[model samples]
Target: MIRWNVVLAGGIGSRFWPLSTPARPKQLLPLVTDAPMLRDTLDRLRPSAPPERTLVLTNAELRDAILALEPTLPPENVVAEPRPAGTCAALAWAASLIARRDGPEAVMVCTHADWAIGDVPQFRDTLDRAAETAATTHALVTVGIVPSRPDTGFGYIQPGTAIESAPGAAGEVRRVARFVEKPDQARATQMVADGFLWNSGIFAWRVGDLLEEIAALTPEVQPALVAAGTNLERFFADVQSIAIDVGVLERSARVLVLAGQFGWDDVGTWAALHRVRQHDGQDNAMSGPTYALAASGNVVHAEGTQVVLYGVNDLVVVAREGLVMVTTREHAANLKTLLDAMPAEVREP
Candidate 1:
C-alpha cells in the first residue's frame, strides 16, 4: 500500500505566551532542537512517506510560512484550512485527496506537528508497524504510547483482549477497550497503574477504511465532505467543530491500538520544556541568550537580550520582542485564562 502522511500544524499555542503568536506558532518555533518542530516531524517521517506524499495541513495564515520552511515539499502538498474545522474534517479532506491520487488502499499516517519525540528511529518504526497493521486488517489503527507516568494533560486508551497480528504486520495489536478523556491526577495515576496507554494522537489507516467508517459512523462532518467535493473551504464552513477522536475513532468498532514506546510529548504548555529540553544540574532549560544561576526547575526563553535568573526555582520566564512573561511552573498551563483576560492588542503581540 502507498504511504501518505498528514502533519497537522495548526495551533495558536497560547500557553507559550509572548514566544508563540499566531504568525509564528509553537510548531513553527525551534522549541526543542535547533530546527522547528514541523521540520523535525518531516525529517522523522520522510523515511516512511516521502515529501511527495507527505501533506502539511495548517491555518491559511501560516501556509506561506510552512512552504518556506519545507521547500522540498510539493507546492500542492501543502494545504491550508480556511477555518478551524477540527481534525476530523482535516483528515477526511486529506484521505479524500489521497484516495483521488493514489487509491483507496493507500495508508495515511496522521500526527500533530508540535510534539517532542526523543526517539526518531523508534518513532518511524512504530509508524511503519501501524501502517502495516492498517493495510493488513483494514482497521483504523492508532499508536497508543506506553505511559511512562500518570499525565493528567493527555487522554488515555484502554487496550482490550489480545488480537492476532495483521497479515504482514508483526506488531502487538489489541482491540480498543475504550477511550478516556483527560482525567484528574488520582484517576490518571489509577489508570496508568491499571495499564492504560496514553493516546499519542498518532494514527494510521487505509483511505477506504477511514472514509467508509466516517460515512457510516460520523454524519457531523461526512455530509459536508460530500457536498464540498474539492472545495475545502465549503467543507469547513459546513462541518461542525468536532474532533476526530470523538467524531470517528471513538465510535468505530473496527479500531485497533498498537502500544508504542518512544519518548513523546505534545509540548502543550511552557512547563513541558522542562521535560523535553536538556537541563543543567539544577534542572534548568534555557534557550537563546539566557543564564540560570542557582535556579532549579526553571524554563527561560530569551530572544532579545540575556535573561539571568538567580535564586529562583520552578519559574517560567520568557522574553521576546519587548514582551516579558514570568509565571510559576504550576501556573504555566493556565496561560490561556491569563491571555483571555488581557486585551487583544496586548495578547497578540
Candidate 2:
C-alpha cells in the first residue's frame, strides 16, 4: 500500500502568545530548533513519504505561508480549509482527496504539525509499524506515547486485549479499552501508574478504513462528507465541528493502540519548552541572547533583544519586537485567559 503523510496544521496556537500570532502561529515559529515546528514534522516524515504524497491541511489564510515554508511540497498538496472546522472534517476531507487520487487502499499517517520528538529514528520506526498494522489488520491505529510523567494536560488511552503480533512485527498492538479526558492531578497520577498512555494524536489508517469508520459511526461528519463530494468549502460548511477523537475513533470498535517510547511531547504551552529544548547548566531553556544568572528552571525566548534572569526560578519570559511578557511557568499554560484580559493592540501585536 502507498503511504501518505497527512499533517493537520490549522490552529492559531494561542498558548504561545506574544510570539505566536495568527499569521505566524506556533507551527511556523522556531519553538524547538532553528526551523519551524512544521518544518521539523515534515522532515521527520520525509523518509517514509515523499513531498508529492505528503498533504498539509491548514487554514485558507495560512495556505500561502505554508507553501512558502515548504517549497518542495506540491502546491496542490497544501490544502486550504475554508473555515475552522475541527479535525474530523479536516481528516475526512484529506481522506476523500487521497482516496480519489491513490485509491482507498493507500495508508495515511496522520499527525499534527507541531510536536517535539526527541528520537527521530525510533519515531519513524514506530510510525512505520503503525502503518503496517493499519494495512494488515485494517484497523484504525493510534500511537500512544508512554507517559514519562503524570501530565494532566493530555488525554490518556487505556489499552485492552493485546492483539497477537503479526509474524515479524516488532511492536505490540492492543484494542483500545477506553479513552479518558484530561483528568485531575490525582487521576492522572493513578492512570500513569496503571500504564495508561498519552493520547499522542498520532494515527495511521488506510483511506478506505477511515472512510468506512466515518460512514459507520460518525453521523456528525458522514452526511456532510457524502453530500460535499469533492467540494471542500461545502464540506466545512455542512459538517459539525467535532474532534476526530470524539466523532470517530472513540466510538469505532476497530480502534487499536500502539505504545510509542520515543520521547514525544505535544508542546502545548510555553512551559513545555523546558522539556523539549536544550537546557543550560542552570537548567534553563534559553533562546536568542538570554542569560540566566543565579536562576534555574526558567524558559526565556528573546528576539532582537537581550534578556537576563537573576535570582528567579520557574518563570517564562518572552520578549519580541519591544513587547515583553513575564509569567510564572504555572500561569504560562493558560495564556488564552491572559489574552482575553489584555488590550486589543497588545494582544494582537
Candidate 3:
C-alpha cells in the first residue's frame, strides 16, 4: 500500500525558552540527540516513506529553515502555513494534496516532528500496522501509547470493542469509545488503572477516508477546504483554528485505536529530558560539559559553556547563548509564565 508521511512541525515551543526562540524553535534544536528533532523524525520515517512522499507542515517563517535542514525533501513538499490554523486545517490540506497527487487510496501516516521515540523498529512496525488497518478497514487509525505512567499532561483514549484484524495484519485494533481531556492527578491515576492509553497523536488514514470524514463531521474546516480547492493560503485564512482531535476524531464514529508500546515520549518540557536522554549514575541527564555534584534527578543542557549543579534535586539548568536558566523540574513546565513576566529582549533571546 502507498504510504505518505505528514509531519506537523509548527510552534516556537515556548516551554523550552532560553533555548528555543522564534528563529530556532524546539523542533529544529538537537534536544534529544546530536541532530535536530525534526531531522531525527524525518530519518526515522525515511525507511517507510521516501523524502519525496514526506510532507512537513510548519509555520511560514520556519519554511526556509525547514527546507535548509531537510534538503533531500522536495521544496514543494515543505508546506508553509500562512497562519496558525491548527492541526485539522493542516491535516485536511495535506490530505487534499495527497489525494490530488497520489490518489484517494494512499494512506497518510501522521506524526509530530518534535517527539522522542525509542525502539525505532517497533515504532515503524506500529505505523505499518496502523496503515494496514486504515487501508483495510477504511477507518481513521490512531496509535494510542500504552501508558508508562499516569501522566496528567496528556489526554487519554478509551478503547471500545476489538476489531477483527485483516489477514497478515500486525496487531490488535479496537474501536474508540471516548476521548478524555487532560485529567487531574487522581483521575489520571484512576484512568491508567482502568486501561486508558495516552493520546500519542500518531494517526493514519486513507486520504479519501480523512477527506470524507472532514466533509461529514468537521464543519470548522470543511467549507474552507471545499472552497479553497488547491489554494492553501485561502484555506488557512478561512478555516477556523481547531485541533484535529476536537474537530474530527472525537466526533467521528469511524475511529480506531491501536495500542502501541514503542517507548514514545513527547519531550514536551525541560523536565522531559530526564526521560528521553541518557543519565549519569546520579540520574542527571546532561548535554555538553555539565557536572552534577551532590545532585540527582536533574536535567542540564549546556552549550558553549560549562554548567555545574550542586546540592540540587529534580532541577532543570540550561545554558545557551550566554544565558543561563535554573528552575526546579516542577517549574520548568510553566516557563511560558516566566517568559511573559520577563522583558521582551530577555524573553525572546
Per-model TM against the reference:
0.97, 0.98, 0.98
lDDT by residue (tens digit), candidate 3, 1-349 = 9999999999999899888988899999999999999999999999999889999999999999999998999999999999998899999999999999999999999999999999999999999988998999999999999999999999999988888764234437888999999999999999999999999999999999999999999999999999999998888889999999999999899999999999899999999999999989999999999887899999999999999888989989999866999999999999888987999887765
Q: Please, what is the whole-model Cα lDDT of each candidate in the order they appear?
A: 0.90, 0.93, 0.93
Q: Give me candidate 3's TM-score against the actual structure.
A: 0.98
Ten residues in a row with the worst lDDT in model 2?
A: 163-172
Cα misplacement distance, residue 136 of candidate 1 (Å): 0.3
Task: Specify the poorest-scoring 10-residue window by lDDT in model 1.
Answer: 162-171
lDDT of 1: 0.90
**What's the lDDT of the predicted structure labeled candidate 3?**
0.93
Tens digits of lDDT, candidate 2, 21-71:
889999999999999999999999999989999999999989999999999
Clashing pairs in 3: none
Error of 2 at 209 (Å): 0.7
The residue ranges of model 1 lying beyond 4 angstroms of the native Cα positions read: 167-171
Every model's Cα RMSD, please? 1.3, 1.1, 1.2
Per-model tally of clashing residue pairs: 0, 0, 0
Say what the RMSD of model 2 is.
1.1
